[model samples]
Every structure is written in C-alpha cells, then in structure tokens.
Target: MNETYDKRIMKQKTHRLLEAIAALIISAIIALIFSFLVSVLSSSQVYAQRVAGREGLYRDSVYRRVIGQGSTSLSCYLSYPQGGSSVLRGYGHNAYELGKLGEFIRAALSDTLIYVRSVRVCGYCSVDGNYTSNEQLARKRSLGFMQFILSEYPFLRRYGIRADWVGEDWDQLRSLVASSTLNERDEILQIIDRVDIFSGREKLLMDLNGGAPYRMMEQLFFPLLRRVELTVEYDLHRIIEERYRRKLNDREFALLLEQEREKVRREERLLAEQRALKEKWQADSLAVEETARAQQARAQQAGAQESARRADEAAAAAYRRRREAAREASAARTEHRKLYPLWGVKTNLYALAGLTPQGERTTFMPNLEIEYFAFGRWSLSASALYAYWDFAQGEFWGVTSYTLEPRFWFSPTGLCRGLYTGLYARTGDFDIRRSVVEGVPTDNRTGTYYEAGASLGYVLPLSRHWYLEAGVSGGYRRVADKVYDVEQDKHYLVRNQSQSRLRLTDIRLNIGYRLGKKTIK
Candidate 1:
C-alpha cells in the first residue's frame, strides 16, 4: 500500500510540472515570433527613387559602353572669341555660352544611365570673307573647339569626335535675311542670288545701296552665321547592360518629355527662318528637312514612353527575385535555430517503485541511464543502479544491476521526441532476507540473474532540453541463486539454481535531460 501511494505521488508531480511550465513556454514563443517578424519587415522595406534619370554604383564605372543600346542626342550653340580662335573666354560674350555649356555638361557627366559615345562640332563663317580664307577660319575654329573639349574633359577622347566646318554659310545668311524685317531684306536676297562667293559676291554686296544693306548684313545676319554647334551622342546603359538598371518613375519621365518639347521648339524656330516657299526662294527642301526633324522628335517621345514601361517591369521583376532569395536565407537561419540532442541522462520512475524483489521504493536508490545517439536515428543506452537498505538482524533487501539497450527512432528528426523501439540485455545480483517477527520467517535469498529482451518506448518533449519517456521490455530470464532459511542463527540452502523463465524483465517511465549546445533562437 505504501509503495503504491509513493508511485502515485511521483506521477502527480510530473503532471504538475507540465501544467506549470507549458503556459510560460507558449507565451515566450509568441513573443519571440512577433519580434522576429517586425525586424524582418522593417529591414526589408526601402523608400527611395532613382536620382532624376540616373544613379551610379561601383560596378557602373567598370561597365563598358554597352553596344546595341538606345542613344541620347543633344545639340547646343556657343558664343566664341573670334573666327579662328578656339579659346573659351569667361568675361566677354563667352560668359553666356560657357554658362549654357556648363549646365548641359554637368547633367551629362553626372548621369549614370548613359556614357558619352560621340561628339561633333560644326563651325560656320560669315559671307564677307574670301571663300578660301573663310574656309580656313572655319576649319581652325572647329578644330580648336574639338581640341578644347578633349583637353577639358579627357574622358571624351575614348569615344573621339568629328569636326565639320562651312567656309561661307550662304544658306544660313539667306535664311536669316528672309526671317528679318530689315528694309533691305528683299534687295539683299536678290544680290545673294546674282553673285557667287568667288565671282565678286562680297564686292556686289559692298556696292549695293551705298553699302547700307551690306553693313546691315555684316552686323546682324553675319554674327548668326559665325557660330559653332556641338552635338553629343550618349549610349544608354540599359541598352548596353541590364545590370545598370533603374525604375523609370514620373519625375524621370517628365524630364524626358521636356527634352522632347525643346526639340520641337527648336524645329519651330527653324521653320520660322525657312517659311514662304516661292519659286524664287525654292524653300521646298528646307520644308522637307523640318518635317523630318518633327518626325524624329515624335519617335524619341515614343521611345521614352516604351523605355519607362519596360523599366518599371524590370524593377518589379528584380523585387520578386530579392524576395525569393530572402526566403531561402531565412530557411537556413531557421534550421540553425533549432536543436537536436545527441546525448541524454535519465532515471526510470518504475525502477524506483515496487517493481523489484524488495517490493518497495526508497529515495536513497541511485539509478541512471546514459543514452547516446551517435548519428540521427540510431542510439545506445546503458543503465546502472545500486540500492542498499539495511535494518536489524537478517532484514535486508537490495539490488545491483546494469543494462544496455540499442534503439532506433522512427521520427524524421530522430530526436527521440516521438516513438522509438529497442533491444536490451541486462544482468544483476540481488539479496533479500527477513527476520522471524510477527509470523514472518527468517528466510534469506542471494542471487545472480541475467535477461535479454526487446523493448518499445515513446519520448515526449517536456521542455527544450527535457523529455519524458515510457517503455517495457519482455524476454527470457535465467537465474542462478542460493536460497537460504535461517533458524537458530544457522543457514540452510534450498536450491542452487532456479528455473529459467520467459517473462517481462523491466517496466520504465523515465524523465531525461538532453546535454548539448544551446538553441540559437
């Protein structure tokens, strides 16, 4: 009755521990999961845009001019020092032109989306000079500017440049004169038609109307002719290499649209100079050029819109790839964060109960089973126990035993956190005695025994590093023992060997702790 009561008490304590700790474990898990999600989401979100039309990364500097990519074309007009000089002057008329060039160059140089591919400088001289001298002057002017650009920004040399000079820009003069509201505009146009540059064209203009029309042309239309035009072509990185990519947002699209509008306005200005197609003027060719320029502007606008749509799609695709990569990374982290134990130490509650020859439990008994799972699924366990209880004359009952078991867990994790089965062999020595008191005889028994068996068990996790287990073993047992009866302080042997038996050898309900590294999360 007393042993049964003690066994019941141990079971109650185990249940109470489970109830008390489960609530705390659940609360901690909830807190940990919540904090992890918050951190992941916060770090994943990024709020920013591609700077205007371009931004750079370290890889951008090494990327070559991507071939077969779209191109950006730009043209600008500049003021100069003289007809033959290539030098840039800051204080004089050069100031206005330098300021314009500065703003334009800054934008191009800073843009990461494109690289300078080609530069073309076109120089034109006025009609007053002789053809050969004017041609020489224009050539020098174009050459000087091209050399200045290469020297100022040496990187442009990688792409190189082309220079074209117009010796006498009679076309530009005629166009400017036609647009002007000068009193001598009609007479000047007639004079230009009548004389060639080598055949006294400058002399006839000097003789016209006491040189009033000639002087006016030299002052007004001539300055417009003595100008240089610089054209730049850039290679779009997106066309060259997809690695240097950015999403085209509204701001970038608006900037492209404004550039297209500027082209249209420049075309309108040319149209003003080339208006009125009469037989004498023969302006049909100029009209055709203006129409073609307008068509080119339309094509550019269409290309920008298409590029923006494609860029947005590319950005979305890139985001999806990043999310997929993050999930793979998180799975790796989770695997590292969970732990599986390779070794354990445990005690069986049933062993300490009334299951032995003594038929009683004692707190002083020492029982331990050390289990080792060398790999994932297969394991070996060794159990040992020694018990000693003594009182007055011939009243002693105790046991000393050792057991070995080899186990296999069916669980995929092989943590023994689920069901498992094993085979076991055990050997032991025991002594039991009693004194003649209150109708009990003075009987003694000293014995040695061995058993071999198969076992089945289950292990349940009680905490991260703790487990509760139960199993039973049943097979053949062999015993060789001496039985004794004591009378008048003498001993009598009853048998030398007891019969072999097939029976249950052990019953187990164990509590174990895993020993290994701590879990990461």
Candidate 2:
C-alpha cells in the first residue's frame, strides 16, 4: 500500500510541473506580442522632432519669401507698444503680424487645429547708430516692438508670448554678421561648424543633428537683416479641434444669460441710487450756498454772526462723511476680483461615519481632500478617508482606506457657489481587520479596491474668508481579495486557499469650511 501511494504522488507531482511550465510559456508569448505591437505603433507616431523640422523647414523657405513679398503673411500681430519704430523693431511687430499669419495658417490648416508649439522672436539692429548702449537699445527695441504688437492686436494674446528684454547670443550675432557678406556665406558656414547650435553633442548623441544653422535670407538678400523673426508653431489637428469645439457649456450659457439680466437690474438700481444721491446732494448744496449767502449778507449788514460760521463748518463735515460712506460701499461690491480666470483651489474637511463590526453606524470620523482643477471646471482629487461601523448583530465590520478620484463638479450657476453636485469614482488600496473571530485575534490584511458615488453640496459664505458647507455623499465600495493562499498537496494538486470580495454601502454627512474670499451671493 505504501509503494502504490508513493507512485501516485510522484505522477501527480509530474503533472503539476508540466502545468506550471505551460502557464509560463503562454505568459511569455502574450508579453512578446504586446511589446511588438507597441513598437509598431511608436514607429508610426509623428513625434515633436519630426513635426518641428518639417514645419520649420517649410516656414523658413516659404514664409520668409512671402514676407519679402510684402503681404505680411508670416507675422504675428502686435498689441502692446501701440505703434512706433520701436514697436516695429521688436517682437511687438511680430505679434501684430501673427493675426495676419493666422489667417493663412487657418486656411492651411483647413479642418485641422493649430497649436503654437514655440515662438522665439528676437530683434536686432546695427548698434552704431543708436544713442543708447547697443545692448540697451536692443532691449528697448525688443520691448517697444513687443508692446506695440500687444497694444494693437489682441489675437497674439492666445500664444502667451513674452519677450526677452536683455537676452543676446553674441555667437549668433557674429554668425549673422558673417553670413551677411555674400562672399563669406560658405566661410561663415565653415566657422559655424564649430558652434553648437545645430550639431550639439546631445543632438549627435540622439542622432538628430540636422547639421546646419538657420540663417534669415533677407540679410543675405536685399537691404538689411535688421528684423525680427517670429517662429510660429502649431499642431494642425489639436488647434482645429479646440476652435471647433469652443462653445458655451450648458451651465455657462445659462449663467451668461443670468448675468446679463442681473447686470441690467443692477444698472437700473445704480441709476436710481445715483439719481437719489445726486438730488439729495444738490438740495443740500443749494441750502448750504443759500445759508452762506445769507450769512455773508448778514456779516456785511451787522459785524459778525459766530453761529452762522459754526453752521457752515458743520455742513462741510457732514458732506465729507457722506462721500466717504459711498466709497466704502463701492469697495465692498468689487473687492473680490477673480484672481485666476479659469482656475480655483479648494480644501475640504469632512466628518465621516462608518458601520461597526456589529452592524451599527458609528459616529463621525475625519476626512480631508486636496483637489486640482481641470478642463471645463472639473476636478480630480485625492482623499484620506476612514470609516468604522459597528453593528450589534453582524460579524463583519470595519474599514479604513484612502482613495484617489477623478471628480466632476457641475455648478449650475457656473460659479462654484450655492448648489453644486459632483460624481466621483475612487480606487485605491486599504487595510482592514475583522472583529476577533471566536475570541481569537484576527489577522490584519491589505487589498486594492474601488468605489463609485455622487455627492451634493452647498457652499455658503459666512464671512470673507470663511464659509459653512454641508453635503450628503454616498458611494458603493468594493474590496477585493484581502488575502489569498494556495497550498499544494503531497500529490501536488493545488488546493483552494482563500478569496473573498467585500462590498460596503456608505452614506455620510459632511460639513466643511471653504477657506477663501467673499462668499458668493
């Protein structure tokens, strides 16, 4: 009997070994296939370098000539310097030209979106003629030009273009001078070979050296190289999609209409207030003037009336006080200027309640959240959460977890005030312990899980920097396989070890403080 049992065990062990090997082989094959697919996809991608070179080369050739033709086809519109020779000499001019360039760009893009990847606009002039230091003149010319474009055109505002006031690469300056002489083009190219602009060590390491510096043809062509070149960058697909989809969101559309109506109402109220104040001030002024006239008449008629002088002083004091009060009220109305046009940060602390081991809802626990604002007023936040529930009758009870969530907040008013609702999906790891089973210590375990839920809340300001917020949030949480154990028998047959899924339903009350400016009315 012993011999037969040993044989059976050996045969089972052999079969188990074969199964393990087969599983390993299958896993390797799948991994290899996945890697192959990734490589193929990566090779087909239009990466930054390729796009830059293709677009840069074409613009250097075509756009330069187009500008030479006097159509301003390759310039960014300027807005800041208003208009001047200074504006014309700097990035300001380039910024102005951008709008015109944009029209051609739009046509070129067709259905595609355009993104300005990068713009380096540098302006240079002969240092000999200017009264200012060459560097100082260059800086002023750069800034003046930038300001001109900024003041003239609002379109360049989209690119977030900023000028370098005192930046110069002397090497490039020399290269510019050298390349300007017709006889020295090839000689300058030879000298530039030792320069690191195009063929740097890092570029060589990456096998991306294009092996040449870009020279503006105008300096080599006609009157002068005294100009600013604005490099416009964009991804055709991205810009097209963005422009096409730019629309008022439902809430924003509604809020805009609401704001217009409110504006009209406020204007009417302001007009009424102004009229009332004006009439009151006018009447008071007339009374004071008449009294003064009467007092002066009396003074001329009979020596002096001290009482009349005192009344005149009191009237002046009252008028000053009234003006001061009006100014204070105006300040209160407009003080909370929106700092960020489209971004806000919020911190929230909530008291949490959870079920106990015995199946009773426990008292409040603590939770906190730090959130980031994303596109379309949506937010993604991470939270540290704790839930403890005790029940009088059930065996399972207790959980403490942390979750990362991508949250979407819908503010019906388009302003994050009053009634706002959010839907959040959270997933993370957690540690939990079951109530001591049979009076023995329960083992502590860990697992990864996910939760989904929605929350409704209202933010009401009680003061400029403080607000009272309350909301009810509920979610379904699923905890998977806290622990798994596999055992192999003497015959090498794998035995079922352990596995379980824990699902918890949570409904909690939360009250929080909003730490920021004036409460939204």
Candidate 3:
C-alpha cells in the first residue's frame, strides 16, 4: 500500500513540471507579439502634423503684433558694423570689407519669425560730389558688407541680402531744413532716417524722441543710417521658439549638441577672420585713395607741360585698358574653376520609326547612364539599355542589354579653341525578337556587339558659370548569334550568321548641362 502511494505522488510532480514549461513558452510568444503591435501603432502617430499646426498658429499671431495699422511711426538709427562690402566691388580684399554691415543684418533675420524675406543694403557718404559721393564707392561699401557675411556665414544666403548705392538722400533735405534753426541749417549737415525694415514682423528696435509732429513725415526717417537695421513683423510664439526654445533629443542627444556647438565656433572664427581682414583692407584703401588724390593733383599741375608728350600719354592709357581687361578675364576663369568634378545621371527616352526590309516595327529603348569626372578634363561613364518592340502586328520581338564604355581625353593647347576630344571602345549584348512563321515557336537569338568610336565636343559656358555642350562621333561594329535544335539537346547546337560584320557611320548631337563642378574627368 505504501509503494503504490509513492508512485502516484511522482506522476503528479512530473505533470506539474511539464505544464510550467509550456506556460513559459506561451508567455514569451505573447510578449513578442504585443511589442510589435505597440511599435507599429506608435510609428503611425501624427506627431509632426500636430507640431506643424501649432507652429502655423504661432506665426500668425507674431506677425500681427510686430506691424499693425495702429502702430505709430518711430525713428531708429541703422548702425552698420564698420568695414563691410559687396561681392562686386572691384576685385580685391577691400571688396568684402566695404560691405560688412550688410552681413550683420543678414545674419540676424529669422525667416520663420521676422519675415525679413528680402533686404537691400545701401551705403552713402556725407560728401555731395566728393570721393565719398562717388556712387560706386558707396555701393562697393554696401556690397562689401554683404559679401563678408555671405562668405563667413553661409546661413545669410537664405536671407537674400542685396546691396546698392544712393549717394545722398536729397528728399530729406527739406525735412532737415524744417527742423533746424536758421543758423543750424547753415551748417550744411545731413539728416537721415535709420529704419531697418522687415516684412510681416513688427519689431520696435528704436523710438524717436520728442520732435515736430510732421518731423517724421517730412524727412525720411532712416536715410542716413550708417548701420544695417531690419524692419520686421513677427509672431510672439515663433519669436520665443527662435530665441529660447530647445529641440528634443531623439537619440545620442549629446552628439547633436556637440555638432551644433562646433558649427557655432567655426562660424565665430570665420567672422573674426573676416573682420580682421576687412580692417586691414579699409586702411589700405584709405591710403590708396590719399595717394591717388595726390597724384591727380600733381597731374593737373603738369597737365599743360605734358601736352607735348601726347603719344606717351595715349600709350599709357591703352596699356591700362589692356591690363584691366586681362585682370577681369583672369578673375572669370578663376571663378569658373570648381573644387569638385561634375557628376549627374542621364536617362534617354528613345523611339525608332522606320520600315525594315522584313516589316514595320515600333520600338522603345530606354537608356540609363551615370557619369563622373575624376578631375580636370577626365571622365568615366557606365550605361544600361533596354528595348521592347513588335513587328508585322504578330510576327516578331525585344531585348535588354547593359554597356560600359570608359575612355580618356586631353586638351592639346589649342584643339578646337581650348576644347577636348576622345576615342572609346564599347561592347554589349544585342537581342532578337520572338517570331512564329508556322505553328511553331521561333528561337530568340542573343548576340554580342563590339564598336569603337571617337567624339569631339566643346564646353560653352554661359552666364553664372553654366555650361552648354555639343559633340559628334562615328564607329564600326560586328555581331554574331547562336541557333539551337528543336529537340533541345545540349549536344545539338548550330550557329547562324548574316551581316555579321559591317562598317558603321554614327552621328550624335548632344545638349546637356553640368553642375557642382566644371571639370568631369
């Protein structure tokens, strides 16, 4: 009786152990499936949509507050940072130095908040017709300031900073006259309104002190502003986000922060370099101007005496013109040289319509190509081709192929006026379409073709470093195909050949563009 009781107890223990193991396996499977469902649901959430909707509302409110109908006109001084210039201020270091102030204004604008979409920075001087009054000089100063910012901080490119020259604001003279006492008016001093204007954002940076009620109306408020200022209309929330908000970390948050900090430091260093270079340039320019003035004065004194040497003077003038032209051309070529080679892909949509000796066929061929230039005048390319066609309305067929052609070219001193030419060899597959003459399926022959060719082309550059290309070429080709027996046995194979070798005449006309780099190797 005791032995039988022990056996029953062992059986119950074994069954319990098996049941526990099964339960664990089921729990693990359930956990995995639940996790997958949670992930899928979370991924489909419209978090970005919600954030964008909130941002839109925030923008509208900011705009109304910044520039409203009831807002009174206030005068503000436009203080441009000293030493700024434009990109086109005669080729030299001073070019950027003259436009630095414009750079500062460009950097500070926020498209999302301030709505400062466009800015025109103008530089003017006090002199009526003196050196300072030269429109080009002031213009250069404005442009110099613009270029400095653009070169140092590429972000300013997004703000669209432009520069111009309006030597003096004569319209404001009447206002200045009205506000000045009779004796003070005799001082011949100029009064300018300094209002940096931005669209859509009403940001009040300055306030006019007590003055004539019509004082703001008569003379322009910000004409003589030496510095750069922005006129803006903005939303309050956007301003807050732009000025104070922080972005949430998705992952490796520390890495992102480090990257941002590095970028900031790099920009700061570039700005400092720009400032130092500009200061030196400004000093140099001032000295050059002083020397030029002295020379002009001396020339005037010698004007009468030099008349007998007219030929020499004429020669000197011609030499100066030639020198100027050469300088401009050299500058253009330097600008055209890109740091990297041109890289782009091409897709050809090909259609062929012709009556062959056998029948009429319409074909569509697709060509895909990828090309890259290794460096100065050297390039490599690869391409794939595919075609599908039907002939005689039910008689004949189609093919797919890939071809890779690599070649090298060189520009020989004066070949085609500084252009280049190259010779290339190509090999690829050619396929025949399916056809049925009797109630039997016909064989589709696959063949290989080899061709060699040469091409001549010229790169014609347009305004702003854009290029137009044209070329021509010719080559020879050979093809062969294989035939199989009806029984489809490996040992039963035959080759059929017709028009296997031929001299080919190929002519090509191409129009394309290059971007990112001028030289494609």
Candidate 4:
C-alpha cells in the first residue's frame, strides 16, 4: 500500500508542473499580442497627428500672406522753426544736423529692395493766418519737400510720392494743451473736443484764458508738426527665399509660391476697390456741379425760379449722400486692433474633505486663496485653510493653517487651464490625543507644527468664469506637543517628538472663479 501511494503522489506532482508550464506559455503569447496591438495603435496616432500639424502649418502660411505679418517702416523727425522754409537745407534752426539728410537718402536708395512706398509732408504755422492761407502755406511746404526729394533722388520719380498737409496740427496742439501746466488746460481741451470745424477750434482756443493756451501751443507744438514722414516699404521675400531655398523641399517651395500669388491677388483687389471709390467720388462731384449750373440758369430765366429752387434742394441731397457713402467706405478699410491680457488677479474659495492615514479623524477644510498671475504662465498664491475634524470616538477639534505656494503653468496664453506643479510651505497649530499608558486615560496634547511640501495639480475650465481643480500633496511634518505626566500631575514640553514620515497633508478639490480679462491661445 505505501508503494502505491508514493507512485500516485509522483504522478500528481508531474501533472501539476505540466499545467503550470502551459499557463505561463499561454500568458506569454497573450502579452505578445497585446504589445503588438499597442505599437500599431501608437504608430497610427503619431501619423494622424503629423498630418494634422502639416495642414495647420499650410493654413497659417496662407493667413500670414493674406493678413500680412506687419509692414516694416522707417521714420525720422524733421524739425523746423516758425515761418521757416520746409526745404531740407532751409531748415535754418538745425542746418548742421540737417546735413545728415543726404546720408539718410543715400542709405535708403542704396538698398535695391527698399521701395519708397509713400511720402507725407506736413506743414504748420503759428496760429496766425485764416484757414485758407494756412491751407495754402501747408501745401506749399509739402511741395517744397517733394521738390527736394525729386531733385536728390530722381530715380524715385517712377514711384508715386503722395503729399498730404494739414493747415493746423490740431492733434499736436491738443497734446501740448493737455500736458501744459497752463491754467486754461481744461477749457482748451473742452474746445478741442467740442469743435468739429478747424476754424472753430482755433477761435475757441484763442478766446480761452486770454489766449494763453494758443500761445503755448504756437511756441511748443507748431514747430514739431512742420515735417515730412517717409514710409519705406522693403521686400523681405528675396532674403527669405534665399535663406530657405536649400532648406525647403520642392513641396514647401510650391506652397510658398502659391502664398505669394495669393498675396498679389489680394493687393490687386484692394487697389481696384480704391480706384472704384475714387471714380465714384469724382462722378458725384461733377453731377453736383452740373446741377448747380442748371439751377443758376433756371433762376435767371423768367418763371423758372421755383424749378431752380427744387434743383438747389436736389444738389444738397446728392452732396449729403456722397459724404455718407465716403464715410462708410473709409470705415470698411480701417483695420481692427488686436488685444491681449498682460496680467490678472483672481480669488478662489474651496471646500475640501479628506481623512488622515490613521482614519481616526475626518477633516473638513475650507480654504480662501488669492492668486496673482505674472507674465501669463507663473502665479503666486497665499491661502488660509481652517480644518475641522470629527473623531469616531466623539472628539472634535479645529486647526488653522496658512500656505504659500508658487505655481508654474504649462499653458502660455492664460491661467486656470492645464497641468501645474508647485512648492508649498505650511505652518499651523493642531491638537491630538496621546496613546493611553498603563491604566491612565489618553492625554490631550496641543501645540504648533510646520510642514514643507510639494504638490501636483490639474485645472479644467467649467465655463468662462469658473474652473475646477484637484490635487494631492505629501510631506514630512514636525510636531511639538505638550504631554501631561498624570502620575506626577504636571505638564512637560516635548519638542520635535514626532518622527519624520511621509504623510499626505492635503487632498484638495476646488472650484474657482477667474477675475479680470480672460485670454485664450
């Protein structure tokens, strides 16, 4: 019987080992299949992302050409004295400095790619002439500057040089009035704002505060406006193409060429629109002139005076319509300004509940925090947490803690979205019960403690103004408690009595409201 039992036990052991070997082999096969599937999925996802990224780059290239990155421009200030000639050499007050104008023109002409896009010459006089004479003087000054440019750079004659002049530099005058310490500053500004006509503005300024404001503007501001502004547009395409010719492949070059063609089309379309507007304006002016002639002829003829009156009314109506149309067309061509938020401040109130590792107490922490964002990505916050705990043994207590944290966000455009990590320091007071010793009851201990820790958190936007956040923090804490020796009936101080162990200080879920302007990237 003993021999038979030994044989059976040996057989059973062999069967069990075979079964174990089979199971391990099957597990290996399953793992290989899973790994292969994961690799295939990962490769597909990477390929999809690459295609999407390429498409986005293509779109952005077109947008950059259509809207234009920005125009590159050069500007120089030309100052003139009162009643001075606008000729470059005739700038008598700064003749020695004006000699540099030749060098400036030489440098601009030296660059083959630099094109003189436009020239604007503005002239000013002391608030001395009637609007008509002031307008003529301004035009003459502009012509003087234009003649100088033409004489020096005759090659620029092919390019259209536009001359614009304002009889009075009202904008500059108002700026001077605003900055001046004169007693009539407010009255002058009121006049500048209230008067729509140039003559009315000048008259009002002359009437205020014994015309002291007008004198201030004439001495300080008018000279600053007697100048010319030359806008030089340069072609960077040649430089960019040369730099990237060897780097970009055929496909990229083709796309770049397409973008350039689109930009040319856009510019042509804008020019056509401007030409149409100009033609319409001219036609409207001619029609108004003809109507005036017909009205005058009818008024001279007998019994046609009433018809002339009707023609006069119709001319006024046509003039009003033409002005309105011009205003609308001008508004359509104006560019919209882009805005961005530089800094922001926000306040958050959160209710957090969690338990200590011992599970002896359940904590309810209410937190109030204020955060300041700087340079978009970095934020610093100061928070106060008041924690109330309920023990299973019918004991209750509260602790107050203050935390200072500095966080950095991964998103560049705004706060309150994406992942963040931060370092924190917390200091607070806590009360807890010490273990019972011998037959004595548990000792109630109270003292202050401090913790230093790090945290990882994520923020998700719930709406335009609200966000949800969750995080975990862990650190070592040093506790100093006062212990009572019941046998001696006295209390003693225990300093640094708690061992340093990794403990979870807080598990927070927060709902926050964002204040100030919110930006999205």
CA lDDT scores, all candidates in order: 0.63, 0.45, 0.43, 0.57
lDDT tens digits, residue span 1-521, model 4: 44563464356446545643554464366446546644643552121111111112222332243225323323234554554445656454445544565565544444222323444444454455677777777778767767877787776666566666777666766787688787877887887788875547767777777887677777877666555555444333432344244455567766775665565566557657867886887788788878877776777785676887887887887788688768866753532111132332222223344344344434454446666666467788787655544444534444557789888888665543679888989898655543445644355555568888888888776544446777777787777755433334333333335545678876666665455452311
Q: Report the C-alpha lDDT of model 3 over 1-521, residue by residue, as the tens digit.
A: 43453364356345544643554454355446546534633443221111111112223322333323211112223233443343434554334543543443332343123534354555554323344445565676666655655686576566465665655444455455556564434222322223222321112211223333224433443344333322322232333333335554444344543443454455455545556555555555455555555555666777754542553455455456546555554554444344243553443322123222133444544444565765455676665544434565343334334445544545532111125566656665544535654544366465556766675655554422224444544466566655533233121235666443334322222222233433312
- Leading candidate by lDDT: 1
Model 2 clash count equals 52
Model 1 residue-pair collision total: 0
Summing lDDT over every window of 10 consecutive residues in candidate 1, give the lowest-scoring window: 47-56
Displacement of the residue 226 alpha carbon in candidate 1, Å: 74
lDDT of 1 at 329: 46
lDDT of 1 by residue, 1-521 (tens): 43563464356445534633553454356446546634533442221112211222212222222222233333334555444466565635766776666666554454333456677787778777678888898898888877877777676666677899998889988898899998888887887888777778778779988999889778877777877777666543333233235455556645654554454454445434334222213333344445545555665778766655554555455455546545554554344334477788787777655354334443334467899877678889999866546545436655667899999899886455688889999998776675657644556676779999899988887755667898888888998877766555445556666869888777788877676543431
Better of 1 and 4 by TM-score: 1
TM-score, candidate number 4: 0.31
Candidate 3, lDDT over the whole model:
0.43
Error of 3 at 395 (Å): 8.5
RMSD of each: 26.8, 22.1, 22.7, 26.0
**Candidate 4 — which residues are off by over 4 angstroms?**
1-351, 357-363, 388-393, 434-443, 485-496, 519-521
Listed in order, each prediction's TM-score against the native is 0.35, 0.28, 0.37, 0.31
Please report how far candidate 2 places residue 390 from its true position, in Å: 13
RMSD to native, candidate 1: 26.8
